[model samples]
Target: MRIVKVMSVVLCSLGIAFAAMAKDMNVGFVYVSPIGDAGYSFAHDKGRLAVEEMDGVKTAYVESVKEGPDSERVILNMARKGYDIIFATSFGYMDPMLKVAKQFPNTVFMHCSGFKKAENMSNYFGRMYQARYLSGMVAGAMTKSKILGYVAAFPIPEVIRGINAFTLGAQAVNPEVSVRVVWTKTWYDPATEKEAAKSLLDAGADVIAQHQDSPGPQEAAQEKGVYSIGYNSDMSTFAPKSHLTAPVWNWAPYYKQIVNQVKEGTWKAESAWPGMDAGIVKLAPFGPMVPQDVQDTVTAKQTEIASGAFKVFSGPVKDQQGAVKIADGTVANDETLLGMTWFVEGVVGTTE
Candidate 1:
């Protein structure tokens, strides 16, 4: 009886040790908005959920984190709590995340929509502009007015890329169309976004589009009796009647890929440049307001691009001043697009 009791105690200790080793893959995420907001941060949180669903991985997140020093504080807190991998999901978290990566050499850190990397840190973002460009094509074909309104935040390259791609797509269908841009310089300011949309409407823009992370712009479109293109996530729920479609970035596949690598001991600091081809960037369902023909045309074009038979930026392209930016017969590559800071002809706004 004494021998059996000793054996049982030894078995219990061994079981506890095995469990501890098996639970080593704890991952953490930080977001700028509430997970339930149904917008930008919500999409990223969903990606984290998908990672959690993976066997042998534990995922956790801290939402509503601020941009600067406070963001660093949150990341450091996660590290202190024994998280093995940390994902900071905001452009503003770039510097802070890099700082923390230096401080925590053993922790693997990833920042979304940022361009800095270290041995312990890496950046990842999708070419959501591909989807945005397709939506713009639909907008051009659908809009009766040649004047399109763009509600945007800061004139950063990330935002500028979408505007340019959307403009290019719109021009593909309606050469006479003009995209009017208004900057809110904020990510989720409802009041600012609404007012920006109103200002664009007041300027005779009949179709609305936005790069901010609020449903306020869509709400403004609904009230003004115009159509809208949403961003980051599908916000048709906010303006079912006026919503057109959205360019959504599905991070789940990428999240799962990363977690699997960590589990298999092959996780490396690499950039994720997923597009329509890889199913990372996609157009949300067309709203009830979209015409069937418009949907067909958009989907066809998307398919062509995905299959590599079509090149959206293959150009005979010229800047606003008629200077050729991309020479005829040349396709603009990722590096060129990333450094782009010019507006094509007929786009009305300064890139400040």
Candidate 2:
């Protein structure tokens, strides 16, 4: 009887050890908006899904969490629940995520679109302006009135950089083109964004582009019989005939790479700002309305940007006031681009 009992105890201990060994790595994601929005959150969720498919990995998420105390609470909850890694996807979540990272030193935290980073936390964003420049080329080629409409989300550097890049691209193709901007100050308000698009249209803008989370601007352009550009994801379905091209985000590969690195005990904290060459950001396919010549031209430019043979912010760049922001025979670096707050020449909008 004693021998049997000893064997049972040993067997039970081994079983418990095996069960623990088989446990999957838990990953958590926090989003500012619902993944069903088919916009920004949706794009990140797609990356989460890719991570979910990995072997021995499990993922969960909280959606529609606000930026302030609410985001902090969600991140803390995930950390306390023993999530191996947490991803807070929003600019507003930056400070909150940094706070949580300091307490949960063992857990890894990744914040998107923010500048804060801790010993165990990292920030990452794509060079979306590169794709924006390409999309601008498309918009510039398609505009008939020489007036481009832009429905913007906020006056942040990210949005401002996109607007400026778009303006530069349009000006590259048609020096006579001008872009008008209207701010909605909200990320996902479809109705407000659509109205802003209409207002720009009313002001003689024949093409619309947006740095927003909804397809509202695209709908407005379609309703007004003009072309439109989209962001975050392929929005061609929403506007169909009026859709031109979009600067889209593809986070799957990057997310998968990070998860793999973490699992292998090789993950480190750093600012990751990859661009088209890394396959993080890309321009969506052109609509049927885009001419073949335009497509070829943009494709060549895309190749140039990806191959490091061209720099979008190369010299002679000017601000809205026509003051030289980038001198001739020079190029703007990542730091300048990150803190960009000025609109380029040919853009009719205030950064404020």
Give the winner by lDDT: 2
User: How do the residues 1-352 of candidate 1 rate in per-residue lDDT, one tens digit apiece?
Assistant: 9999777545543433343356767889999878876678888987888888877788888988889999999999997787778999999999999988887656678999988887667899998888988989977876777899999888888898899889999999899999999999887778999999999999988889998878898999889898998887889999998889989878999988876665555666767777899888899899887888888889999999889888777888888888998899999998888878888776898898
Give every collision pair in model 1: none
**Distance from true location, Cα of 340 in model 1, Å:** 1.5
Question: For model 2, how does the per-residue alpha-carbon lDDT over 1-352 read when each residue is reduced to its tens digit?
Answer: 9999777545543433343245688889999888987789999999999999999999999999998999999999999998888999999999999999988766789999999897678999999999999999998888889999999989999999999999889988988999999999888888999999999999999999999888999999999988999988999999998999999999999999988777766677899999999999999889999999999999999999999999999999988887999999999988899999998889897988
- Output the lDDT of residue 210, model 1: 92
| Model 2 TM | 0.93
Badly placed stretches (over 4 Å) of model 1 are 1-24
Per-residue lDDT for 256 in model 2? 91
Worst lDDT run of 10 residues, candidate 2, spans: 12-21
Poorly placed runs, candidate 2 (over 4 Å): 1-22
- N/CA/C clash count, model 2: 0
